[model samples]
Target: MRLSVLGAGAIGPAAAALAASRGHEAVLWSPSGRGTMGLDGRIAAEGALSGVFPLRVAQGLEEALASADAVLLAVPAYAFPALLPRIAQAMPAGLPLLIAPAASLAPLAFEALRAGLGPRAPVGALATTPLTARRLAPDRVRIPAIRAAVDVAAVPAAATPEIATLATALFGHACPAAPDVLQPALANANPIIHAALALTNATRIERGEAWPQYELMTEATCRLMSALEAERAALAAALGYVVPTLAEALHRASGVPQGRLAAMGAAIAASGRAVLGPAEMETRYVTEDVPYGLSFYLWLAAGRGVAMPRTAATVAVLEVLWGRDLRANPLLEALDAAGLPRLLREGIGR
Candidate 1:
């Protein structure tokens, strides 16, 4: 398929490279005025896959999206509302559009698109990004040695089969069927982890420590993460979505030990790799995951009258640090469903 990869950042370039390697024509697009991504097309350094092939890089969103069979927005959550409507206008109505690793809230994005394009345009949201890619340098994206697995579903539920088929065709085995968007959304693990790591280590992070961030993982952090994950699972279960615990997903991603949640966490600590990035809390895992991701979940928990103390506390701390009421951030409030309170407790797609 002719694919236009919007955002040319860490995840976007990695995916474009994969598609290009598979012989598809993939174009990389970056929005204007953000300063161009590096010569390697958004990556900061060179990697094993760096400069391995020729890629078409475009700085304008519309020009790049104009004629692709599919377009994937792999930018951070913060960048979406700023750019998606422009993309929707440039894209053909029938072409499948995807938002990979859409952080926490899938429904909000669908609602945003609906508000902009009135549901005439079709789009898909991946439960998470297809690859766990990192920007190792100015001209490189270090795709994890282990191939990542992605779960995808389309809005309105009925759109899943065709989207899945097309997604699998471009992405091969990396794209798998998620139970539902809610199932995948509930499965997302970044919000708690990022909020925990960033809040707990903000001082060290602000100090610009080049030290391995992974080594900071502690029993307390992991325990808190588990608690947060459980709270989300409770909300999802009540709403008819059963997602695995954070440790379970971590186990699957990194071969967690003894196949237990605690052991899986132990494996993460033992690995001692900075699972979160060293310096920036910027993209899919952080920025996107928080407001749209964590904040949305918090709202649901509150609306459902479920206790999400850790999530609530995390949001409070992060908002204070960031100096914003994240609950009403554009990304968080983009869709503003008239009956979202109802949808959260009893999902529409499910």
Candidate 2:
């Protein structure tokens, strides 16, 4: 299969290498073009799979989009709005476009793509990122773990089985089908883990303490994360899905032992895949996950009259600490149950 990997982050290089190892062709592209530099059309990979993979870097986004059997957007959630449009304009009709680690990103992309491409275009989301990797260099990545199974959902929901089959074939693993986009979005584990880590260790991040994030997690931090997870689970339950808690999610994805939150954190630390924590509060934990993940959860809770005091409190504190309003995505604010399913199935109807 010829796949186009959009974005040049750790996941992109690692995924490209994995594809090549499976005898599939992959072309990587960076939206900013800066990420493509230092890539001499090859990948030096270590960790889960070690090798020097011969990779092909696309000269431009259009070039990459035009020459692919499928597309994978392995970028940050914030980049979705800007790049999805360009992708819609150039993507071949009927091509499958996947958003890795969907986490509420699928709806936005689905709406954006269908506005121009219509309802038949295959746009879906992965429940979580396919792999955990660290970039050693521009063209080198260290992949510590590949997820055991990734839940996937498509816009029409009927297309899920087909997309799941395709994903399984492409990744050489199980790709389960999610009931809806929201199921995968709420099931995301990053916001729950990242929020607790960043807030509890704000002082450490400020001091530039380079510690393993998962290894050093305290009982207090775990307790707080559990509180947030409870609220998230409540929201998911209200929405009709029995979502897994943070600890369960960790165990399922990385083989972290399930017990108390602290025990899970310790296991994650010893997993050899644990990476260093953020140096400051300005990192994605507070910025991206808070807004896209936790904040979105709070917003949903509020409408349902569900009490999410702990989740709300964390966001409030982070807002003052970061000196920015956390719940500020206009698109999300505009969403409600009455129009949500329609928007998910059809385009924005513009």
Candidate number achieving the greatest TM-score relative to the actual structure: 2
Query: Which 10-residue span in candidate 2 carries the lowest summed lDDT?
Result: 329-338
Error of 1 at 194 (Å): 1.4
Cα lDDT of model 1 by residue, 184-290, tens digit: 66666767776777777766666666544445556776677777787888888877677756665565456544354445555655764335544654433345567
| Model 2 alpha-carbon miss at residue 63, Å | 0.5
Best-performing candidate as measured by lDDT: 2
**Can you write out model 2's per-residue Cα lDDT over 119-194, one digit (the tens) per residue?**
4565677877777788888888998877777778876666778778777777765776777677788888899888
Look at candidate 2 and give me any clashing residue pairs: none
lDDT score, candidate 2, position 27: 93
Candidate 2 regions exceeding 4 Å error are: 330-336, 345-350
